[model samples]
Target: MKHKTLVLSAAVGLLAPVMAGCGDSGDGSDSGSAIVVGTTDHFTATKPNPAPFDPAFAYDTGSWNVLRQTLQTLTHVPRGGGVPVPEAASHCAFSNGNLTYSCTLRAGLKFANGDTLTAADVKYSLQRVLSIHDLNGAVGLLTNIADMDTSGRDIVFHLKSPDATFPYKLATPIAGIVNPKQYAPKKLRDGFEVDGSGPYTFKAEVKDNTLVKGTFTKNPTYKGDLKVQNNKVEMRVYPDAPAMGTALDKDDIDVMLRSMTPDQIKSLTDKPRKDINLTEMPGLEIRYIGFNTSAPIGKEKAIRQAMAYVVDRDKLINQVYGTTASPLYSNIPAGITGHTNSFFNQYGAQPSLSKAAQVLQSAGIHTPVKLTMNYTTDHYGAATAKEFQVLQSQFNDSKLFDVTIKGTPWKEFRPAETSGKYAVYGMGWFPDFPDPDSYVAPFFDKDNFLGSPYNNPQIRGQLIPKSRREADRGAASDTFGQIQDIVADDVPILPLWQGKQYVAARTDITGVEWAVDSSANYSLWELGKGTTTD
Candidate 1:
């Protein structure tokens, strides 16, 4: 789910005076120069990842933000949050009892390089992503599609099982259509440029295999559902929140998103800056500890359960995130349908060494179980190291665990997690879509994306399929509740906290709300440096 956890961000209503100073007429008519965006998010583009920006392999939100502006998917969730709507495909639908999905290509579609887009291109794009099956890619989401073919101007997909959420998956960059001529059929293309029929075409600058800057220019040939408000968007990469904040203060960047430290956010929220606009919105981000079930110590379910029981979510959130986040006890966060407090119901409100010990003793686990907590050094923000440090202290304080914490750079951290190098590690989820299935399937499905050998047959087999079958999402709440209960009992992943979305932008920036939509995908096209017409 890091695809979107993949990253965070600003308020328009509080910036009237700031706009006047920037030469905007309170009405939507002025135009400004290219927009520079600063973010703390990083992606792995070194060995094992040759094509960092290729949608076939780019799964994280940072990369998605770049890919989203350059590559167009068949369908996409609306900017304001809604069901999937056409992007590349003029229309798409489920038929033959939801097992078959079909889409008709938008006529006269062309890539930035002028390659005519066709149903064959869509078919080839989907096939290659599945064929490459990169650990960092979104192949897990497409595993359900048994086969697919192009008939005339239409592409048809046959699923192994009935999956109503397939359309939602298509809405993600995972299904972003690639130019067949530019991308190899089976191998990831090597380069730092994109050629797709989206709102913009991107050319990225890389130094030492890490993205330095990515510039998006409006694609004059773009034909899509979105309206391009800005002609160009320049994204600058920062090492951490403090650096990003510095850039914002120096006017080197017009908007900052994907992250700002909680303390930085608090400062802006407590004392409003006349030149800045802080946009606060309901966020679906959740952070958790994933266990490497294949490891010797991690294989012990009782040990995981004990640790879960000992985790003080309230203390963790309060000390590390303050008012920015709330304690989460279930894999599914609160606002999502079918969410339940399974862990809370099982472990109660406070941390209990007694309960933790009891579970360990019952399962014959030795006292003070040895554990090493691992986290990324930079990707998540400045708060991540502190968050895990707090966790180490809490776990050790329980007297039931002997803990050590390790921090690795994201480039190394990601591959290690997928390789099962850590017994237990920290991870965060930014749902791919607003659906609850996005929360569970990616973590517990048979082809779970986390690489932690967590395979619950009940969740993978029954609960998920049952939940997906119901066209009406609310009808599957009971099934999801059961899924959460199993997760609570197994403890494959320990829920930590859910976040509040914050975006910081200069007061003159417009469309902060719509650009960073509910799905957390940034629509660079929605951003403009003036009072945009409604």
Candidate 2:
């Protein structure tokens, strides 16, 4: 079955506004020339920098955005969206009970530095990802691969089990190939320098947690589906969304890409700025509160269920997020096949204070149940603090719980949360690839991303493996539905809301709507600044 494309809709009511003067019309001057892009996410190699240019070590969305443009993988999701297609490889297939997967590379591929990109380089790059295995990196995605081999131009992978999503996994930037001559096999390459076989090469010097101001020229060695519309692309990093917005309004940046707050999106829509254009696309990004099942407060299933029952998702969507998000009931967000409103089906739309009380009472818990909630203020957004405050009020207002909220920055909170320091904590996810299995498999597996002691044999042993084997994505919906039912019953996490994708660019800039790929990576190649007459 074909995946549904996220239809772009104009905002209604307070959200009612259209792209006033922002369309694909411009003067013939500078047409098909160059463009400059801006973002709030910092791209640097300094301490506390999440935007490491190294594909093996970087996991954040900001880093992936850059890596996607500066690297090439075996397979990639097309801009129009569908199944994964070959990028570096000419074709790929699986055999031997779906255990052995092989791909033959398109001949004469070379790195930006003029190094030959053979199948050996592909095998070495993947091996390096596993060898380094940064705790925060995406090496976990390749755990299914038992072995890798190369014969002539063909790269082969031997999996321990049949995985229908293996090709999709290869399509991600984590599986992007790096030049063996420039990178070490067992350790991550030092510094921010990159030598890749992508559409664009990494350019400019790293300074003060930012890239030096310059344009990144297109890679002549790149052999992929994407064509560089603009020969030169300039990227600038800002400290915050407001700063980025200010720069955009001042004509300092051609486009604003990442980390735009919901309020910013709403403000742009409500005011209808003629100079700026806003495009809303379907988003798979999801935010949730994870319960550390091993912790004191999390050990009790009743406490977890009560917390889920008490969260006011409507308030979160309407108040904090504005019209930028919709209430999500299951781990799998809408737009993906197998998505269901399991939480709503189990509980109701609104918070059930009485039901929460009954759940705790049945567990023989006393009144005023004490619980501490943890969140990251810097990572999620400044609004996260306010959101948590509202949650505290909701839980306390119920008259059955005493909640204490604590927050730390992402750098500190991530380690603490992973170590199970917080009884309950907030987390968000963006898909590595656009697949329903991407949602369920990563979070529910035994060695799950949550780092919380959440283990269900039926889910890990049977349901997930079964879903992975089913070739028909829609047919796998039943297994995913069963998984969501199990999740609703167990209540390891509380689904908050799913976000929508928004990109704001100047009136002269075109192709902002088509910038986002199926995996949600924003492409620099799709953006161009000039008139159609060019």
Best by TM-score: 1
TM-score of candidate 1 on Cα atoms, chains taken together: 0.94
lDDT of 1 by residue, 1-534 (tens): 111221211122322221222333332222657889998887546786667788778777777778888888999876555567888889998899889999998899988888888899898988989998886777889988899988878999999988878888998888888888888888887757777888898877888877888888889999888888888888999988899999999999989888889998888878777778787777788999999998998899999989888898888888989988998989998877778999999988798888889989998888788889999888777999999999999999888889999999878888888888999899988888887898898888865678767887888878899888877677788998999999999999999999877788876787777777544678878787764222
Instruction: Give one digit per residue, the lDDT tens place, for model 2 in 403-446.
Output: 99998876677768877889888888888887888788668885
Determine the backbone clash count of candidate 2.
Answer: 0
TM-score to native of every candidate shown: 0.94, 0.92
Model 1: how far is 162 from its true place, Å? 1.0
lDDT of 1: 0.82
**Which runs in model 1 stand beyond 4 Å of their true positions?**
1-32, 531-534
| Candidate lDDT (C-alpha), each | 0.82, 0.78
RMSD of each: 3.9, 3.4
